[model samples]
Target: MTHDLLRLATAGSVDDGKSTLVGRLLYDTKSVLADQLDAVERVSRERGLDGADLALLTDGLRAEREQGITIDVAYRYFSTATRSYVLADTPGHVQYTRNMVTGASTAELALILVDARHGVVEQTRRHLAVTGLLGVRHVAVAVNKMDLVDWDRSRYDDIVADARALAARFDIEDVVAVPLSALLGDNVVERSAHTPWYDGPTLLEHLEAVPVGTDPATQPFRFPVQVVVRPQAGEYRDYRGYAGRITAGVVRVGDEVAVLPGGRTTRVVGIDLGRGDGTVTELSEAFAPQSVTLRLADDIDISRGDLLADPGRPGHVTRSVGGTVCVLSERPVRPRDRVLLRAGTRTVRAMVEEIIDQLDIDTVDYRRAPQELRLNDIGRVRVRLADDLPIDDYHELRRSGAFLLIDDADGATLAAGMADAPDRYAGADI
Candidate 1:
């Protein structure tokens, strides 16, 4: 059996040891090379530190290394005997909250760190809120810096209680709280004898065992055509195929599908797995995340940016959508502002019809009628698209429900958007 791959993002306030925990996981897992270890040791000695600074493993930026803060999203990849892992270490600073959104958007799990000495702070709440908004189902709260608290069971328990309450406010269901000291490597990779009262899997163990969800075959099918392949000269000269990655569910030969926005029904005649060596293998079926070419029985008008979906449960087709958005660019977003909405492979012109409200991260309430949204502001906004779009509720179908707002002036990304109102905060205060 093939071990499944887990994608996770780590977030925390500045100095909460997010990088240290990631570095320790890599170090203890034997994923780091000898030269990397030697370099970390050299840097530690240069900085007058007694031990190797494991945080150096993920803090690759010079500014981060010198200033001792994560400024951008840093991705690290590693694998163990049982599973492969992709870790996104997000920035902790409030100003870089946009980076956190970018990192956590595609993650299946979120590793939230809390300083045991400081407990939960404003930034902690902000990150937690963002994680909830992104629809990340599973969360692991690492109560870090436990060594500073002398492994006090009461302190750990109190912190865990607080963290759980905060997570609950966001409707986060699966939460595992682990008390560990990233610097000392206690309860990170291996169980620490320092805490006999606590009985839970170590951080690494929890991550390895967490169940992401069912196979893509169980979900609704969604495919956004990225390229229409037509070969003119070859043994297969008449071959015409729609090539794209399956974003959700599965598609099999002879399965009936509908072209979205056009609502045209067709049957999948064949499937091809491109080997990228000028050859291809015919497939009986293909599922989510796989890049494959599909041939339809009817040569209906299909092109890039068109969606192919399960006809039985096609996605929503509409011109107006309301959801939460995190403004990323320095320029503010206001009513009547024209922007480009990129959802899946389709980019359409859209207008900001209304600024519903901005989220008060601290209170978990909506601040009514914000005139405009600035950088790092999370708010509910309604958009009017120039053309009808086939979209899904973000909570139900993440791939089909998410979108991005792009500035038309220079093609800069302005915000990351979701398809429906946040469940927890819907109708919150009008």
Candidate 2:
């Protein structure tokens, strides 16, 4: 039985022990098999290590096999008596910022590792800013290599203070700090007797007890119809459903709904829930975060990329949008740049209307009227869609509102943007 599930992601600078932290969580939780542990032990000895190497457990790709580093996102699943965890261990290099976005999308908490000797670096601040932008409410800061710093309270407190200041700039609500030696297994899973000055919870303790929930049933129902299910086999010839995941809210039987882009009105007739083994329908109330087959009261011009939302809670539709941008490619983004806009499950043609400003992270200076956004540079811009499309404000609903800019020729994702009110949010330094 799936009692409770918490999706989490791990991020930090390269060689800051993100993979090692994931390995520690799995090893101490007894999620790794004997054969896997034996193989890791053999490889550790071959590499001339003093003890078993846990980072080898997650660096599983052939490219990583040759480079000895994680180049893509690695997902790990484990369970305890209280809850189940879906851990997305993402690459930490500045070049792999795109992979971090893929992992942080659905995560409720972020684990940011910091080197005890380095205090706070630029990469650390970058990762923190993304987590805050993605709306992950909880964070765990692991001050690693404590043995190298002699487990000193002064060193640990200094790093904690720096991280706290960064979190404050992002306005993150929750923070937990743990002093550990990932290479030596100090305070990762079981609490270590090394830091008597630290009285806070261990890494796993915080994860196990963290409150994580993003429910659509409570807010408003938004079902972006992905497929029109019309089974024409056996006795199911009359079956029909608008298939898609619930992006924001809920859709229940007899609830009034609006189909957008086509602007059709109807009521939900029935719902069928799939349980992996077989499909089940409770036939009454269906809420957000639940993927099910929805039957409508009337047939309309609904198709893929169409939206199903609450009649009164429909999203804002506009031909133009404005938000902050971070150009991730080597080529700079300039005015009138042509790109494809991906909003939720819908894709539309769009063009870069203007570059309003550029951000200097080192000095926090937002320069006015920048010409282009270079690689790893943050800026503000305006985008004009070819046709009017519905997108929600990021502060209002994350899943229903965020968008990405993709290169039409090579299909490379260039930028990630969230919709805000006209002229962008007044306080969106994120």
Per-candidate TM equals 0.97, 0.92
Q: What would the TM-score be for candidate 2 when compared with the true structure? A: 0.92
Compared with the true structure, model 1 gives a TM-score of: 0.97
lDDT of 1 at 189: 92
In the range 87-166, model 1's lDDT, one tens digit per residue, is: 99999999999999999999999999999999988888898899999999999999999999899889989888888888
How much lDDT does each candidate structure score?
Answer: 0.92, 0.83
For residues 1-430, write the lDDT of model 2, one tens digit per residue.
Answer: 4469899999999878888888988998999999999999998899898888899888878688578678898899988878899999999888887678778878889999999988888878888877876777888999998989899999999999989888877678798889998887888888889988888888888888898786655687788888899868888888888888887776779899988866678999998887877766555877767788899989777888888888797877788888766666777788898999888788899999988787666554568877788776667788999976777877678887788888988998888776766645566653
- Per-residue error at 369 for model 1, in Å? 1.1
- Model 1: worst 10 consecutive residues (lDDT sum): 421-430
RMSD of each: 1.7, 2.5
Error of 1 at 206 (Å): 0.6
- Looking at candidate 2, the ten consecutive residues that score lowest on lDDT are 421-430
